[model samples]
Target: MIIDLARFVEKERPYWQELEKALDEIRARLLDLSDLKQSRRVLGLFQRACSDLARVGQANAEPELRNYLETLVARGYSEIHSSQTYVRRFRPLHWFLRTLPRTFRRQMWAFNLSVALTLIGMLVGGILLVADPDGRQVALAPFPHVAHQTPSQRVADEETANNDKQKMLEERKSSFSAQLMANNIGVSIKAMAFGLTWGIGTALLLFYNGVILGAVCLDYMLDGQTVFLLGWLLPHGSFEIPAILIGGQAGFVLARALIGWGTRDGMRTRLRMIVPDLATLIGGVALMLVWAGIIEAFFSQYHAPVLPYWLKITFGSIELVILVAFYWYCGRKTGPEEEAEQ
Candidate 1:
């Protein structure tokens, strides 16, 4: 029946129109099939019929054709009742994966903008880190008192020196691993949340973050801590930055949706249809956070000098590969039709 509907919609406008009318009749009949035992079967048929009608409507641009298609949809929706079974046996995760690219395609502009901002943040941060001796202080200006001291001044005060040394050693211990993970997760969330202010908040957050990173790198370089810095930052930064980027991407999506709602008359309806995409983006961000937390807490803080630099590089490369793979899978071109099939 689905195949026939597909063929009709593709090849014959008249049959497509007839199929929509037939679906309306089926939908009305299903509504009257209110017996609880038969609800699932009837609801399934109703949903399939409605979906077929929508496909037919979308494949054609004729006003009359669209009007007829919409009438069938309205008729089907009118008959839906609270007693009808809405649940299906299909796995949500499977459907989410199948539809992800289609969702991403619809928000491609937002996605691209977020990515550009993230890269700018990283680049600015890296350059500042390499060039400025007091970059950390500038980056961390929002914090009180911590950035005031020069590296020499900071290292000279016995009390502060001892405290910092102790803190560093404690961080090296496995027990302090959770703190690192928590810190990274908090940073990512903040970056994402800041994006809601029309990307202004995001820009500021990224700039400040970049400054702090730059300052830290500068301090390390000045102190001849290159090897130690590389060992500490590389493992986790690989996953951490990309995760933050993904969060920024999500923020961009929300901003775009809001803009669309304001500018287009029927945008809310379209947004409702794409709610699943927003859910998927949120899910992806959550997954990235979990991965970042795990890496920071366990692998990055390990003090074992015996762990080869090559191994660290390899792991970092693997993380990048995973990030790329996820984007590719979720942005593939054939996603929409495949999702409808599923």
Candidate 2:
């Protein structure tokens, strides 16, 4: 049964034209990969062309037909590969400035949940400290080293504890940023790691930290040191708090990947899909912690003579607003390309 090659070619020519049109549209940016409908259409066309190319090969097709199909397939391959290459090249920058915030916005539900746990812990700790008298001990128990002292006393005790004031000052001056950054990074790592325990570890860690923060606030308020504490917290916490929340969000994402929710793929396959997002979140958290460490070490700790407490709070507030605005609007475009295609 000899097939009519000329008749088959005539029938398939329209399909080849369609494949070429899809490729051209993609290359010209007329078709957006971000739009699911358009992407599926383009993908389907590519797959169909691949199958046609195989069929043409099997048919001992004319040299002209074979060459055309090969060229079409190559063009499609290049378009796909080049787009991926572009993404790989720009991923770090794109993820940081645009994808991170977009992802953060998407995961606000989880972030809010984490914040709720923290706030609840803070509320409980504050209540215990003010109402129970022994609440200080209970609230501080989570932080073993600081458990012996209230927040109001901790700063003064640290300053006076060392008889070698000069040596203490030297040590702090050299290692302050490093120490603060290490601690913050450690917390983020813990949050992400403990997320594997079905987010229980992450929640508990956040709650515990919140309790400590609340106890400190309560102690300071009771001692009429509210101004001092605000000066201490506001400068670095504006960034640190958000970073911690993002960390918890990463943990939650990991838990979802583990639980096999919203995906039919295997655990490892699902994990691969989300690894890039996790990296972006953790990377942004790292940058925030670095900024926080700088503020905590150099700016927040300076005293009234060098920098007034009110001035510190004012500047910190300004910085906080700038960071918030950056996340809210950065990398977001308002063009037709941004819209989802029907």
Candidate 3:
């Protein structure tokens, strides 16, 4: 079998070079064969290398060429057998901006359920509070500040408190921030943890939150404090409320994992699968709460004189819209990942 050495080398050189480039990229963690097209391409190249190696041996091709192909084939074999998992350095920005949103979108059904439950609770609480004004004691018992004083009176007290109220607010801001963060974080975690109860506990927690929120808002609205309500709550409430809902979303994800909704995987397997998602959600919620906490203590507490209601409302509205867009579009695959699978 007379092999045309020059012709064979020319024909196979491109494939060999291509395989080498792929291997390098994989080593540097620049390319991922998790994409089916890429994976098949690598696999095909590996087979071709094996076939070429056999021909090289039979034809007694130059030892230098044979050694190069051998090394290339070996690299491809290791990669194909067990794709290297290049652990990325933990990046807070990437996690917050990309991973969190991606995970949120993946578990959006659960998030929708959470929002629905909260809305229902809000409606129920609002109706009850409006229908039975005497039930303020029972309905608003959880919030003594709003419950004890009329909305107008509370507004008066907050707006009038302190010599140079700005200085007073700044002075106590740290303590207030810590307290708010602690309280909100506690509530959010409890909501997520309640997923152990097949989501019933989670649903009830969100609902209770909604009820309190609804009652407070309705009381303010009825007392003709809608502007004050929006100005005060909108700033921090925008981030704080959604953070809690995401917490509830995380709970529902856990509940689905526990219940094994559509998947046939075992309970442990299912739970194990969602560990990353749970962590991402909890982390995202914590960050949002931190922002809310700071805003609540420093910014939300201010009234018309200190921070204009329009400015505050606009800021909060911007934050809410950005948050919504982030979840809807961030980290979505629209590139070659959308290419037809191999």
In model 3, the Cα lDDT at residue 325 comes to 91
Which segments of model 1 are wrong by more than 4 Å? Answer: 1-108, 122-136, 140-195, 214-230, 261-267, 270-274, 304-306, 329-342
Best by lDDT: 3
Candidate with more favorable, higher TM-score: 1 or 2: 2
State the lDDT of candidate 2 residue by residue for 218-268, as single tens digits.
Answer: 878888877777877899989998888789888888877888877799999
**Against the unseen true structure, what C-alpha lDDT does each candidate score?**
0.58, 0.79, 0.88
The lowest-lDDT stretch of 10 consecutive residues in candidate 2 is 333-342
Model 3: ten consecutive residues of lowest lDDT: 333-342
Please list the residue runs of candidate 3 whose C-alpha ends up more than 4 Å from where it truly belongs after superposition: 1-86, 164-168, 333-342
TM-score of every model?
0.57, 0.67, 0.72
Tell me the tens digit of each residue's lDDT in model 3 across 24-69. 8877778887789997998888899999998998998899989988
Q: Please give the ranking of all candidate structures by TM-score, highest first, separated by commas.
A: 3, 2, 1
Model 3, total clashes: 0
Q: Residue 329, candidate 3: how far off, in angstroms?
A: 1.9
